[model samples]
Target: MEKDTYKTLAAPGEETLFKEKNSKFFGYAYPVNSEDEVKAVLEELRKQHNQARHWCYAWQLGTEHIQYRANDDGEPNNSAGMPIYGQIQSFDVTNVLVVVVRYFGGVKLGVGGLISAYRTSAQMALEASEIIEKTIDVHFTLQFGYQNMNKVMRVIKEKNLDIVSQKMEMDCEIVVATRKNNAPTVLEALQNLYEIEVKTS
Candidate 1:
């Protein structure tokens, strides 16, 4: 069976801080849906931490069809961004952005040290977030006449579907949403009704 649920952050996580060899790493996590949102958050953080030496970050955008990106931001390749991304994967969260801003403290940590610091900072950020599971939903449009309202409503109620919208004129139209796993059953029930047209939307 295909999985129909995903975990994500409810809101921006509280800022996290980690220090190693006098270098400061500031970590932040935010719920985001698009690359644009990710970019905007990075822009805001750069402004907020103008004196920071590096802004390494990672983001995962989708649930089923996953999309992700990691930026080293001048750190050694795979030292900053990939470690942060690994933390995201370990936490099993999507639609989330993790950023670790570094303040150089007159010391240069080697690749291994940098990786450990970035990974720990990212993990702390995720731990501070409120993770929640959400169902992947499928939408369907049901079209019928007023005469078939009762039949349509019965199926919706029986299946515990959510009514996204409805127009109850003589020609009735309803938009309903159900969990992706239950969509086939809901579609079949609606299609079984006479004179009712159902289409996935």
Candidate 2:
């Protein structure tokens, strides 16, 4: 069966802190839907942590066809970004951005240490977040005459479909939404009605 639900952060997670050999890693998790949002959040963090040595980050977007990016931001290649991204995958979340800002403490943490620290920081940030599951909805546009309005309303009421928009006139039109799993059933039900036009939007 195809999956129709996804997990995502409900809001910005609480800031987190991790330390290794006197080096500081400040972690943050934010809900993001696009690259623009990711860039905006990174810009804000850079301003907030102006003195930080490095700002490494990772973000995952989309639900089914997933897209993601990992940036070391001057940290050793694959040491910072991939580890942080690993935490995001372990948590099974999308549409989220995790960032780790570091302040050098005069001691160099080798690549292995850096990976562990970044992974821990990302995990901590996600742990502090409120994760929520949401259904993937499919929208359909419905067109019918006034005489068929009652039939359409009955199906909508019976199926508990959400009405995104509706226009009532000589020719009525409505935009309805239903969970992806139930879309076929809902579409069939509406199409069965006489003279009612149901098209996936």
Candidate 3:
């Protein structure tokens, strides 16, 4: 299966503030590929919004099959993070993160107002940035003996294939990572020179 790719920007290295009414929303958005990156961004947002009333966030990650999470961060359940997450989904994007900071406007925007504000903030930030889609890479493992190691390695290097991992057993096991669209070509090239086992990861 060919994987899809998308591009997103990272959060500002420094904090940025957006205001509506008396409330100040400090926020930052970043591109994330895995749970660890999402968690790191959430932690950074928490730290940046330490003095604010709430730190809410949402993220979408993966290629064909993606996962997402949202947190209201102490605000009325579903009022903060959900709205921001909705915006992310609406954009049909993956591997993206959005954090919204609320300072409390003194005048509550009510549920509707909160939702609108957060959604708009997230949408605007995404719109202001650039996004690109590319092909996602897939990994395959090839096992062969020392006799064919040099030939296999040469093909990988010449084709600019990613060598994700390697191990030596009775036969050498090499894990190669390449774009899904290129898998067939890569496999054919390898099989021509040596016996190879291809597996997806």
Candidate 4:
């Protein structure tokens, strides 16, 4: 079995915000998820920071299969969104959104400076909060006789596997929920211990 892939989230129903200041630009970046959600967030941030010059953004959605978008907004072409998007990609994150709000500080920052500001702001925001990769949820069912139930249960316990559901009839049937990557190992271990039926769902 191959390792399951997932993206990282900053926190549960929480967002990370960061601010950076250069001689020419003041920037704020937010790391988020979902296009509609990030758009709403950008609107709110724009409203809150009405004086800002530009609100640029980027987002990556879906699982290992992903969809992505970036917007320069009013900044130089590819300055804001591209850099922010690069940072998120560098971290191999998916299902994430980033918006960089720029407040012009009266001086003109060249394209390089603009890119640096957006990238730094996003990286900082991600670093400030705990980012955890998502896990793929998979379930497996194991069936064995009463004679093997105790030993199998012990092994399951030792593995700290999540018991999603259980059924007991003439024999004992157990259902385990865990990441897809771990399911094969779990099933192999159980099979080694005794005659058991394993099904992945």
Candidate 5:
């Protein structure tokens, strides 16, 4: 069976730039998992761009991408944050963040201009980034006596399970990571071994 996977920014911390009407927009992209990670990235940007006029951002999390937020940061409503989020959706990426810092240049860009500027700046940053495919994973601990170890090992080998850790002796324990979507099949096969012990951690 195929495992579940999704597209996301390769890693955190890519900087790109876009300018309009002498206003410099510095866009930063980050691969984030939790809200805490997003906050850390935002805080880092705030410290780095303390003089900037606006710090707008958008983030999407989880495979379902049910959690997300767009912050305009003093920019006109629907101008800054939404546009950045639009680009994230456009890229079809989740578990990612884009923040654009605007250095005002005395010229006031109206709503339309602000939207376009933010959108384009964020898009540029995303374009400069390397997107990657990631799989949802589950971890489990498998234990058995030496007598039944071969049965468990054979099943693990057949499934190509990732060994997170292993302790092999008279009694053996193996910690494995595998795609979350494949867990049911793998777990069922492992459990079929009558004398083996399987536990998820």
Candidate 6:
């Protein structure tokens, strides 16, 4: 069965350096949710490692890990990017990006060597970083009158749902995030309140 939650890098950046056959490979891992963030991080890496020979990378997005990419940056096909991505899959984590920057050391490592180096470098980065588990959340918008605030709050407290945001004016509105697995139960309970309006976001 597919999991309701997943593991990903907890923080933004982690680095690992591997030297093989006199070639230097610097690996960097980052937590990201969108492609724009991926571009931003790659651009930043370019700025930081301006003199590197290749900027190979791989990224997986979303809990399902369906959206992903691998770029070899000029290295032989499957020698660099795919190996780096293999490490990501091996870790069984998503919503993360790993970039490996290669600095030519006057020693030419063949395809096999390149793959080993990239994979090891990527693994080193993940091993050094913190991994975090993230639950899949379903968002909801709740609208109700102030008179029902107590009732709604009581249910929220009982469920321990995360109140993403709330407004407490004449027309009270609250946005909440519930674990995807618990959404049905929570929605059923909320429906019992006739006056309160609930909509999934």
Q: Model 2 over residues 3-88: C-alpha lDDT tens digits? A: 99999999999999999999999999999999999999999999999999999999999987899999999998999999999999
Q: List candidate 1 stretches off by more than 4 Å.
A: 167-172
Order of the predicted models by TM-score, top scorer first? 6, 1, 2, 5, 3, 4
lDDT of 4 by residue, 1-201 (tens): 565867676552234444444332333334456677777777887888798778777788876567888899888899888988898888777777666666666677789978888888767655554567767767778888888788878987977788988888888888887777776777677667758888877
What's the lDDT for candidate 3?
A: 0.77
Model 4: how large is the Cα RMSD against the reference?
5.5
Give the number of the best model, judged by TM-score: 6
lDDT of predicted model 2: 0.95
The TM-score that candidate 6 achieves is 0.95
Alpha-carbon lDDT of model 5: 0.90
Using all chains and alpha carbons, the TM-scores for the candidates as numbered come to 0.91, 0.91, 0.79, 0.63, 0.87, 0.95
Q: Cα RMSD for candidate 6?
A: 1.4
lDDT on C-alpha atoms for all candidate structures: 0.96, 0.95, 0.77, 0.72, 0.90, 0.91
Worst 10 residues of 2 by lDDT: 192-201
Worst 10 residues of 4 by lDDT: 22-31
lDDT of 4 at 143: 84
Per-residue lDDT for 23-104 in model 1, tens only?
9999999999999999999999999999999999999998878999999999999999999999999999999999999999
1-201 per-residue lDDT for model 5 (tens digits): 564888898776568889899999999888988999999988888999999989999999988536999999999899999999999999988999999999999999999999999999999989988999988888889888989877887988999999999999888999988898889999998889988889987
What residue pairs clash in candidate 4, if any at all? 32-97
TM-score, cand. 1: 0.91
| TM-score of predicted structure 5 | 0.87
Measured with C-alpha atoms, the lDDT of residue 27 in candidate 2 is 96
Residues 25-140, candidate 6: write the lDDT tens digits. Answer: 99899999999999999999999999999999999998743799999999999998899899999999899999999999999899988999999999998898899998989888
